[model samples]
Target: MNYMDMYKRWLNFDEDTKNELLNLDEKEIKERFYKELEFGTGGLRGIIGAGTNRMNVYTVRKVTQGLANYIKNKGIENASVAIAYDSRKFSDRFAKEAALVLNANGIKTYMYKELRPTPMLSFAVRYLKTTAGIVITASHNPKEYNGYKVYWSDGGQITEEHAEGILKEISKVDYDDILTMDFEKAVDLGLFNYIDDEVETAYINLVKGLTVNKDIVEKAKNDLKIIYTPLHGTGNKPVRRVLEEIGYKNVYIVKEQENPDPNFSTVKYPNPEEHEVFKRAIEMAKELEADLIIGTDPDCDRVGVVVKNKEGEYIVLTGNQTGALLTHYILENLKTTGRMPKNPVVIKTIVTTEMARRIAKSYEVEVIDVLTGFKYIGEKIKEFEEKQSKDFVFGFEESYGYLSGTFVRDKDGVIASMLICEMAAFYKLKGMTLYEGLISLYEKYGYFKEDLKSITLEGIEGSQRIKEIMDMLRNNPPKEIAEIKVREVKDYLKGINDLPKSNVIQLVLDDDSIITARPSGTEPKIKFYFAARGKSYKDTEERLEKIKMEFLRLTI
Candidate 1:
């Protein structure tokens, strides 16, 4: 249907929605009602307000009704789902809204008593043996946005096959036909339940068990001063509990951001990958002369780490650097401790640092590259278990996501935080810092660095422009970038490397630098990822800036 038809259909829903729609100008109306909110593999995400193209009570319920239909169509017995939410605006309401819709459809639902992390939702699905799971989170996006994530019975986000099925069901759902029941009534009918402390303990125990070396954390717990910030989101309780249970003595929470604040008042984006988000944590680290600083995004699926450099100044570590550190630590420690498993494997996205591959190779472990998404990594873990072909050791992506152990089939900041500090404690016991450990790795292997740049173009026109940029790059591929020769260009749209077809282009440079261009699946943005092998950090930094500058000039 056209925007006008969609607008009229939504006009009489509620007074507040009517007011929101009537107040908008033509341009605002077009932007707000251009199309229904996208429901792809990433699920629904948009600015929160009234409109078919945004996230609101209507859209949330409609999606749930579709999911309920999908579950019922599968002919499963005792159909149930696990539901959780983060601290985003209207998140709790959306969570309950979804549960009530499921309950009305004669399906069982379990929702968290309070806000929880996305990984916990993934875990809860398996822990509760639910048929599916849902999470209301935008995942470090600005406060204006919110999202819905769907997970299948395997405790992983819905893959393409399931997404297509749900999307089909959603296409058949009509807003007027949506159903919901009173929360109290649903509870009385035994169709609705709330999850609390019991599940949290089970998750924490599993996180603690993933530790590579427990003795190091015990020995260095007192001496290792660490500062952590949850950034006003759901990481506060579980992250802190895991650290404490693992015997870390000197861990400090940044007081300013210890509690949940939906607006994320302290930081602009609530994303841990950005250095600016860690301002307060760095200040506290400097004051305490802390050994390390760590922060998790709102949903606690991604994490960031900060450690002192040789100059005595704290700096944020890139996702690549942290992934490599964890890879080396896990493999080397397991080997030395005689705990290395046979046929162990590490997984990474196509755009993640090759340094992980090098480190994994040094230990004779296999490295598998998947498409750029944590769900793909999670899917691989499930595949490994099913085939009994390879042992999944670790998995990471460049966007501040890491995961170990199969307890949760997504990137888990709670466990990532635990293992990062443990790695820091390991280096501290050697009388060295993580920075020094990284430098040693560079010395043994070649010096490698990676950087990213993204240009966000919002609304309809912006999306068209992104497609144009991709087309230009693909039709007339870059022979060289910043004076370096491009050895080859691999267009993923043609289904390269036996992977699923995607709209991505990768340029392999003569200097061993790999530049990848892909549009963000969930947001109105196009991103560029760069990797370079240089003689030193300075060389890589300079060359990276030059390439980024020249490439943007060409693309923009």
Candidate 2:
């Protein structure tokens, strides 16, 4: 439908929506009504407001109705779906609306009684044996945005085939035909159920069981001083509970960011990957002389860390550094404790640091590289379980998302927080900081550093520009980058490699450097991932900078 037709539909909406539409300027109205909000490979995400292109009650119900229809068509014996939400604006309402739409379709729905992390929702789907799951979260997007995530029966986000099916169903759903029932009526009719303490306890127990060496946490729990900040989202309760339950006593919470604040008042963005997001936690860490500082994003699916270096200054560890540290720690500990599996395997994204592959290789474990998203990692876990081909040990991306156990199919920050602290504690017991441990890994594994650059191009013109850039790179491939020899080019779009098709291109340099470029699936941006190996830190940094500059020049 054109913007005018969509605007007429909005005019007939409730009074509040009508007022919101009437107050918007021409530019604002056009941005919100020009197109329907995108339901990409992940799910629907947009600024939360009134319009066809925004995340609102109408869009939420419309998507849910389509999901309901897809579920019914599958012909599951008992059609049920699990639902959870974060602390984003209208997340709870959206979760409820989705549940009501499912209930109105005579499908059973279970929703959290309170805000929960995205990984927990992934777990709840398997725990409850629901046919599918939905998590109302935008996942570190700006506060103005919200999203809907759809999961399949295996507890992973919907794959491409399922997404295509749902999208087809959504295209056929008219706004007027979307159905919903009153929350109370749905509850009384036994179609809607609220879940709380029971699921939380089960999830916590599974997280605790993932610990490789419980004795280290028990011994260092009291001496390890750690500061944590949830960034005013869903991590507040469950993260704290897991730490305390594991016998950590000196843990301190950043008071200002402990509660659920939809606005994320203190930080410009709720993303943990940004060092600025940990400003308050860093301050607290300095005051307490804390051993480590950790921060989780809004949905608690991604975590970032700050640890004291040999120079006595706290430094934020990049996602690659943390991933390497934890991977080495887990594998080494399992080997030492005689718990190492026969066919252990680690998974990483194509864009993640190649250091993970090196670390896994040192231990004789296989490393599998999947596409960008963590759901691909989860899908691998499911494949492992079904085939018994390999044992899933650790999986991580350079984007600060990590998963250790198979209990949750998504990247889990709550359990990751526990494991990261536990790794810190183990190293502290050895009279070395995490920084020192990282340096040792470099000495052993060779110095490997990575850099990621995201160029945001918004609006219609911006999107066109992004496409132009991708096209230029794909059509006129660079034979060499930064004067380095290009050994091979793996264009994912062409299915050159034995991987699923995606709009990604990877250039492998003869000197062992790699450059990957792909448009962001969930946002209006394109990301470039660069990796370099050098004899020293300075050499690696210099090479990374030169390559980054050259890539930028090409894009321009």
Candidate 3:
């Protein structure tokens, strides 16, 4: 339907929706109704409001109906969908609305009674033996945004084929055809059931079992001062619980950011990937002389780390740095314990630092590079489990997401947080900090530095400009960047290296520096990733600055 028709329909629906629509300015109306909210590779994520292009009860029901149809068509005899939501605005309502839609379509639904993280939803799907899972979250998006993510029975986000099938069903759905049962009626009829606490207990126990050095944690429990902040999201309870259960007694939670606040009042951005988000935690860490600091985003799937350097100043470790450190720590521990698998495998995204490859090779373990999303990493784990070909050791991306154990298929901040603490304790017992451990790695693996630059372009015209930039770069590929010779260009759209097709271009430079340009699948922006290697930290920093400037000039 057109914007006018949609607006007219809204006017007759309810008093509050009508009032919201009536108060919108012309530009706001156009932006809200120009297009339907898309179900991207991850799922539907958009601004939360009263419009076809936003996230609301109506949109949630429509997508759930599509998912219901797809699940029925798959011929699962008695299909069920597990549901969970984070602490975002309208998250609880949207979760219930989606469950009711599924229930109305004759599917069983299991939903969480309270806010939970994304990884827990993945675990729930597998634990409940449900056919699929749905999570209401916008991840680290701003307060105005919300989202819905779908996962399959294997405890991973839906793959490309499954996404296409669901999108086809969604295309056929109309507003009037979206079916939903009353929430109370669905529960009375046994079509909807709340998730029990046992599931959570089981999940926590699974995460706690992943500790590589329980002895080390117990030894440093009292002396290893640590600071953590959930950034007003779902990580507070679970992260702290796992750490405390594993014997970390001196954990300090950032008081202001502990509780769930939709506005995320303390920071400009809720994403832990940004160092600015750690402003409050840094202050607390300094006063406590904490050995380490950790923060997780809204959904608790990604985690960021901060540690004191030799100069006595706390420094935020880039995702790559933390990832590399974790990789080496896990592998080295497994080797020492004589538990390293015969064919151990480590996984990372293509854009992540190549230093992972070097670190994995030092242990004689294989490193596999996949596409950017954590779903691809989870998919690889599923494949390995099925084929029994390679043993999955560790997986991570450059976005502060990491996975160490197979208990949860997705990137898990719960487990990552626990392991980060244990890893810190292990080094602290040796009289060194995580920053020092990272410096030692750099000394061994040639100082490698990486930077990400994202250019945001909103609205219709802005999207077109982003496309123009991508097309220009593709058609007239540069032979050199910042006076460095381009060794090769890998266009993922054409299916390079036996990977799935995607709209990504990666340039390999002669000096082993790599640059990748890919549009954000979840947001309205295009990100450029620059990686540079040098003999010293100063040399790498200079090269990174030169490359970043060149990329910015081209984009402008």
Q: Per-residue lDDT for 160-189 in model 1, tens only? A: 989989999998999878999998999999
lDDT of 2 by residue, 425-446 (tens): 9999999899999999999998
Task: Show where candidate 3 strays beyond 4 Å.
Answer: none
lDDT for each of the candidates? Answer: 0.92, 0.92, 0.91
CA displacement after TM-score superposition, residue 225 of candidate 2 (Å): 0.7
TM-score of each: 0.99, 0.98, 0.99
Span of ten consecutive residues with least summed lDDT in model 2: 490-499
- Residue pairs whose backbone atoms clash in candidate 1: none
RMSD of each: 1.0, 1.0, 1.0
